[model samples]
Target chain A: MDRKLKEAIASKLMLLATVFSSLLIFAVVIGLIQKSRPILATHSLSELLLSSSWFPLRGEFGFYPFIIGTIWVTVLAMLFSLPLCLLTSIYLAEYAPAKIRAFIKPLIDLLAGIPSVVYGLWGILIVVPLIKDYVAPFFGYSATGYCLLAGGIVLAIMVFPIIIAVSEEVFRAVPHEIREVSLALGATKWQTVKHVALRAALPGVIAAIVLGFSRAFGETMAVMMVVGNVARVPSSVFEPAYPLTALIANNYGEMMSVPLYDSALLLSALILLLVILFFSIAARIVLLRIERRVM
Target chain B: MDRRKIEEDFFKGLMILSTAIIVGILFAIVAVVVLKGAPALSLSMLTQTPKGGYYLGKGGGILNAIIGSLYLAFGATALSLIIALPVAFYLREYASERFANFVRLSLDILWGVPSIVYGAFGFIIMLYFGLRACLLGGIIALTLLILPIMTRAMDEVMRMVAFELREASYGLGSTKLEVVSKVISRQTLPGMLTAVLLAFGRGIGDAASILFTAGYTDYIPHSLFDPVASLPLAVFFQLGTPFPEVQERAYASAVVLLVIILLTSVSSRLLTKRWSRFVIK
Candidate 1:
């Protein structure tokens, strides 16, 4: 094709892609503009947010149980993933010899590339049975190993790669001069890392962790597979529970066309979007705040 | 120094332990998926449909779903590349700061929008405009899901083409289009292709948007307006099954999806690895 023809064709292609997504966004904008009328709740939105009852089949759609379940699992997953991902990132970024770092980084890369479903199958086969027989029963439970512990434990494993990759990048982004500055101050290598390079990258580290949180919260398949999909507020960490993402992924296929059911699903999705958006914005804000402090 | 040695030893132990565990999980997951899925792979499984394409049934392989995923993803990627590049070029290369920021934030929010919400949005559009869970709906929805990544990637490629080189072209009395299209865009063709492939990777790996929007199909898609299935949806629907054989197939399908994503990401990263040269006069 002539240059004009090529440019014209390329422009047309770009037009098509933009228009495709434009249509979807237009649909979402319209839906937002046409909000359903608000229903009066005797309980406040806070109560609705905090209550743990999830009896959707019993004409009750309080999603507190699912939210709490999601929160506990997500929190625990982070608690486990954060330290490990940080330590690994530090090893890759600072401590490891060049050849060793090069050798090991691809493994982390491969871990990042694997899809969530693979982890779900592993959890079901390995983690669930182990939890059921060895851990849950020891804490006084039946043979059902699928519980918050199993789900949370596996979720930690799933997010480790993301945290390491992002945090490693952030750690590398710390200025060379900062390390020189720390060394000039007579600090040891570990002291420079702990007091200077890591401190410099703290905002980005926080951002990566928050992003990991959102990823864990948004994850559906693996958690849905292993969480056992129980709706009651988890009485303990060993009990089974549902997460918001898993709830939508599991129930949407067989929702039986109930109006409330559809609305409730939308509500949960909206809440998830808001929660992720909230964390994203919060991370940006935190970074901005850190920048201002440095300024 | 003694305490430091102990601390180093402790941290080293922690690092090796954690890294080994992470690597072990990845290997274990792959092995387990194969162990579960290998027996379910058969010739008929490749050629036949699953129990009328419902996850509740046991007999049908993902023949149609596999074909459907390819068609919808191919269509979506093609559509997205056609549309997203200029918008990205316009915003990143040509637009003012405020406009670019607005577009960037819009796409950032778009990327953050839940897949189910996107499906819900697609449903509203489909119902309102007489579109259904056919290839068109799925393509459009997947296009939306993929656009942010494409635009972002393409913009990065354009930005890396060097401002001084573009300025030199413009200083030679060339029009802005000549500088942008003939000079910058040409220099970054490989990068742009990587961008397109990356978007395709994300588009093909999705399950939730297709779950409601693409609907399901047990036959080859003969028209762009027909309901279709994709690999992620096939894996998803199959994983929900109670049948052991079908569940195994789901793992195999997931492994396939993971492999595709893995190749895409690694290839994109490899393609974009670059070095910069500076001149002094």
Candidate 2:
């Protein structure tokens, strides 16, 4: 009887796990349906997203600028961050002494755990003032640096750890024998790193950089704080801009215009979701091909 | 050779310089926050209620907020573990066939779904079920939020306990439950704790979800039904007005949040280090 009871309990537990997994998929399906429901009403969903004016309250809802803004800030952030992160990762992975690497690594990891709100606080108090007073006007730009320039700069800082940590993992994964052979052939440390180590880890590094791009693309809190939350094409690199994540965060609270507002917000979210899924899948496919070739 | 040497030196210098810049951003953020947050720090500000003014001490103690954040996070973590641990153990120890693999892949997609979107889902659905603006609602929301992580981490840990170990325990007449409770959980205690700590940290930092459900208040929570203040809410609510004093408290609270994160990270590092050493034998 005890053995039978045990088996019954075990089976029940497994069923519950199955149910929880099903529930999560159910959630994604609901969110997708909410987003895609607008297709029933509109012939041209592209225009809904592509129109520049986003007056959802007046019923002319266009999420174009927000999408553009998100892409702009993210592209700018990647432009600023990628090269810097690559060089830094190479330094830590190839050049840093054991003691220093151990010491500095956690500090970077600590940055990962620090809440987005704290970064927002820093952006407001320090970044905004510096921008308002100095940066924007200096470049014959708007009255603030709380634009693409400031937001991208801060985002690069925020995502720097991810780039370094992931790229370092990839760099470490490169077979030592390849580096060994290169060194034995009298290739210098830099040459072996440049030609062999980095080459071997290039796909993984691409994965890391792409993930960083997606993060910058989807970031909300700090960008909301530093970008002055303006919805205009940047007058200059120093001029303020809005992004899709910031739009969702900033506007979700007071959007009471029924289906129109909900439809617009959900559509943008769906687009952002698609963007993330695309990059993630692309990275996996690319890495799989690379891994096969290496094997 | 000379040109190559020059190029190498320049590249190395740039790498070191950029890394310094990255580290500098961390320092600069901390310094700026402390500079703004310090003058506002006082006994009453730490412990009093808000009045007016854009600068100096003006608000109530952040004590309630701190306490609320702690209880909610703890409650949420407990809920997540309760829901996730049994499920994980069942999945790993008993389940068979392609269905299990399919379920696992779905869990991965759930992991990628944004936290804000989850918040949106919870706000609408949880409210419909009468779980509205209460700590219980917040706790439930956070449980769902952290469940995927807890289960995935725990599942991996349980599976890493070798078949031979379980066999040896069975040879000594231990049942499956005994093997799980005594052997697996004990062996994987550090990994389990790390996962819990990570979930706790995420819960503490979370704001978007709570902004919709766990409505903010200044008063201390007298019952689970009472709406409560948390660090994230404190920061979010203060952003509306132009009061410098309230805003500065937001910075101090931000500092406190960072401290909580730092402490959790440090503790987890220590725990994992000790566990790896324990496993080396």
DockQ each candidate and list the results.
0.36, 0.46
Model 2 chain A poorest ten-residue lDDT run = A255-264
lDDT of 2 by residue, A100-164 (tens): 78877887877777776777778777777787788766766556557777788778777788788
List model 1 lDDT by residue over B148-204, tens digit each.
778877877777777788778878976555666677677777778788887777688
Residue A275 displacement in candidate 1 (angstroms): 1.5
User: What's the residue-level lDDT of A102 in candidate 1?
Assistant: 86
Distance from true location, Cα of A47 in model 2, Å: 2.2
Q: Tell me the tens digit of each residue's lDDT in model 2 across B1-281.
A: 77767777888898889888878887887788777777766777556544443224444667767877887788889988887777776676656757666666556555555555556556656545876577776776666667776777777777777788778888998766666767777777888888888888878887765656666776677887787778877776675457766677787777677777778878987988787654523
In terms of TM-score, the best-performing candidate is 2
| Candidate 1 CAPRI grade | acceptable
